[model samples]
Target: MNTRPGLSDTEPAPCLRIGLLWHSVNSPNLGVGALTISNIAIMEKVANELGVSVEFIVLGWMDKSFPVYVQAPNVRALALNGRACKPGGAFSAAVGDCDLVLDIGAGDSFADIYGWRRFLYLAYTKWLVKRAGRPLVLSPQTLGPFKNRLARAIAAFLIRRSDLVFARDRMSVDYARDIGVSRKIIETTDVAFRLPYEKPSPWPGPKEKTVVGINISALLYQGGYTRDNMFQLSIDFPALMDRLLDYFAGIPDCEVVLVPHVLSHRAVEDDLSVCQQVQRAHPGVSVAPAFRSPSEAKSFIAGLDFFIGARMHACIAALSTGVPVAPLAYSRKFMGLFYALDYRDVIDCAAETTESALEAVTLAFGRRDELARMARHSAALAQDRLGIYEDGIKDFLASRIPNRRPAPVAAKSRLSA
Candidate 1:
């Protein structure tokens, strides 16, 4: 066989080229990072079991300041952003080269609630992959809550075209069916549940007291994106955070920590800013350090005796690690995922009053030992449920790629060394 130019004869070819759409290994939102890390673990496992060499091409919202940190030699991030949507751009070429595309829709971007821009971003990625005649798979993520006709149609069209659709919760499954999409939907738990974390060595804290962590979403702190209660929750979010803090502060020997999950530079998206402000209002409250990766955030949360948070993934990090967690739910995704895990110690922020929500959280904290038992039990259930998803992934990857292949060119643009 003639050696292709620029391709050394000694270099082994990758058996498969996989494109992960809406997958960002580096993001201020640790939740997104959690999904990215968990999904990659699955892909790597599937590839190894199939005896295939795989190269992952991660494509999503990338910025120069936040370089991709995939921590894999075979993974690379394309510099192209929205420009990749065009027919003749590098994204198109990247798609044409891929053997398969796994789109997690940024966990729940398949829903129209975030805005038209995000929905279209996900829709176009699916459309372009299908147009390129490549296999498109919807990695386990929330499917939909498309409010309008146009959004519904667009979502249904992509869901229908996808080679496989894995819904992370039952509500997503129901919503997909409601939108007239029944086929190709596999119900599973959030990938964050399976996200890996490092066990932190004993961190210096008041060892005799209950160490509590509260993750306050800056978006909700200022009343959603518009800063005017855009999520339409009945309760006032700012008031709830204030009340929870005061309640915890009054408890003797309780060491409270402000943990920020979404660390975006954008004022509204930056949890650290809000957490700092929160700490000032109530002195003696410690602030958690800014973590470089999702695993780091999970590890810090793992040390907490109890965690209550508005961010679903932050709560997930706690509960999944056997820390008693009471999720401050602002959306249906919370109820869907946790309930499916057989964990019901959730505070419905969307529906409850600020006072009532605080009350529920206080009650949950009072039952810390019980919640810990349930958290451990739920973690076990999560493992059992996630096993089904792992099996599904194994079958899908095994059938998609052959055992033998010619050596392919190495990726030029790398996310991390």
Candidate 2:
């Protein structure tokens, strides 16, 4: 970890430098984009409290399907993928220039499930940061389902090296310990809980109808990246989707809108493409216009009366906004996160048959009001959980960055003074 000499009686430094790893505001996967936007907001809040201006360097890859949103003067976005991660490259200089490096593993890429290419890409960058002697913090995220001994060994090493580690759910916490991570682990909620958004000015869906927003993940729809039932799910995804659309159509005064979260350019990976196909098949269903930013997508999602999503962050967008959601989960991350918040409305594709899954969703729809009430409560709890994460961040920054101003003393209260 890098440190600066104390200012003694002098005021704090003019700028605090931070390097964000494995994050980009331009990712086609809006889930990663949401993490980027929300993290910046959180850092800004803490910076205000410390009475300091922050100069952030966002070091990550860029996806051509999306436009860059980190255009703020305080933030410098650098695409550091491929050969750019070497010692003398921009990635190294960025780490050297910053006071701290915080890695989120793009929220879940720390594991080997994505294959060696991605694992190496993420791991090598962390190695660069450490070799540069910069302090690294692993922000709250799903740590791993490593599955391979070597991958688990590497993950455990990184967890051990990080100055501060945070796991966003109980399962991640348990996994961290299982991997021999001895550091004190703080359990916190996802940062997306605090993502800022504006409500849609005018409701886009049909008025006086139950507006249901559905997010379909093209990756899952195509059966993982291979399009050969890669995840080995017992239920048929295409059939399930068809059934959902037809079933929702049967309800009187109900409208369904397809909300695509991943706007990848590749046809198989792009959610909007699948959504367009759904629109073609069911002419009554509407597909949302492509959003320019994560906030925009979340804003549109927030306006929905009810939401069912395959994308974890899209579901998060709904949950954090107090809009009730039923998550069509295919991963442990979903079950861990939702169940941790005690708002269990996740319909798992692995465990239940299509009929059983639909039954659960149907029951949840009937109890949407109750779900909404629980969602409101859970949102509050999410913030409360985030306080632990916030405090850890504050303590880390305060220790490294000197204060610009003195703490104010409180005035004594009087009964009638």
Candidate 3:
């Protein structure tokens, strides 16, 4: 095993080369879509402290029309165009000369339909590493229930062979254990926790009234969950926005702002549709424009009296800033995050949503003091857990790649020798 001076080590060090692997560049919610971006941002800071050089390899098909480039210093972005690189070619191009390969999970939207294609990407990467006989580390990632047997087998095989495994939650830890992945398995929080907090909103407005914020995703509508027959739910969100305006109508000074987390694709359009419906219902309700940076989004969320959203990161942004949040969970990640934070009481999604969302807001208002306390505690917990992830990455590198020279002896000891 190799050893190097990481942040945890008590010695100075040489620069290290690190490779980051991810699937896509564009994301509707900058928080969710730019997870790799967040990871790289944190690593850049850590690497600078530890004297390491970092390079990013984004593995997926490239659209020449929409070339994506990571905009960070000392970081090079490699786009392995899908057609030419394929899985094998992408893996080789990404990890060929790197000292350590950090395998971030692939596009999660594909997993929504129980698609096996996501597993194929992971399996192929592992195959490449084994073929080259190099070390590969699995970062804090979300594993699947594996609806397809072939996908499950492939995932299991890869998990078993990885040099290191760090699950983002307890559920992932259990899943890996169940599949007989006996490698090092540790639980850590999402890497996004390390991202810098966004500043407060600059716009001046009445500071007394509670500002209710909602981040809606269009994916729900497209997935048929919005249809009355499919989900047996009648919350025509656009219409419901009107009802909410009516509900809050007489409350003096209270205002509503609909924030769209996804600003592009069908999801963005869906969010816009909901916004338009709300605007039609109540002509005066103010709506914020799509935010471009995670910092700006976080800052906006921090000023909210309360937040309700289908997107996980929207809620996370609120929580990260000490604002009370109620998530309209559309996927397991939503439930997983709440459970990880031990805030299952705050989430209301799909069938469980409805008036409960209103009730949660009321509770958030009533228990504002308690919620603030909990938020402070949870934020600290998030910070500590993130430290574990940072330490884990450095330790993995130190153990897998030893330092070239041994520790120096004291001058007195050397003289005796």
Candidate 1: global Cα-lDDT? 0.82
- Candidate lDDT values, in order: 0.82, 0.83, 0.60
Model 1: CA > 4 A from native: 1-14, 201-206, 403-417
Clashes of each: 2, 0, 4
Query: What TM-score does each of the candidates earn?
Result: 0.92, 0.91, 0.79
The order by descending TM-score is 1, 2, 3
RMSD of 1: 4.3
| Residue range 1-417, candidate 2, lDDT tens digits | 112355443544446777989888588888887888777778877866755557678888887656786566567778877667877898898899888988988988888877788888888888889999999999889988788899899889988988999888999999889988878888997888877788667755657899999998898889887788776666778888888899999998899999999898888779999999988999989999998788888888989989999999999999988898999987778888988998898988888898998888888989999999989988889999988888899888877766433323211111000
Location of the lowest summed lDDT over 10 successive residues in candidate 1: 408-417
Q: What is the lDDT of residue 373 in candidate 3?
A: 65
Residue 88 alpha-carbon offset, candidate 2, angstroms: 2.2
Kindly state the number of residue pairs that clash in model 2: 0
lDDT of 3 at 108: 39
- RMSD for each model, in Å, please? 4.3, 6.7, 7.9
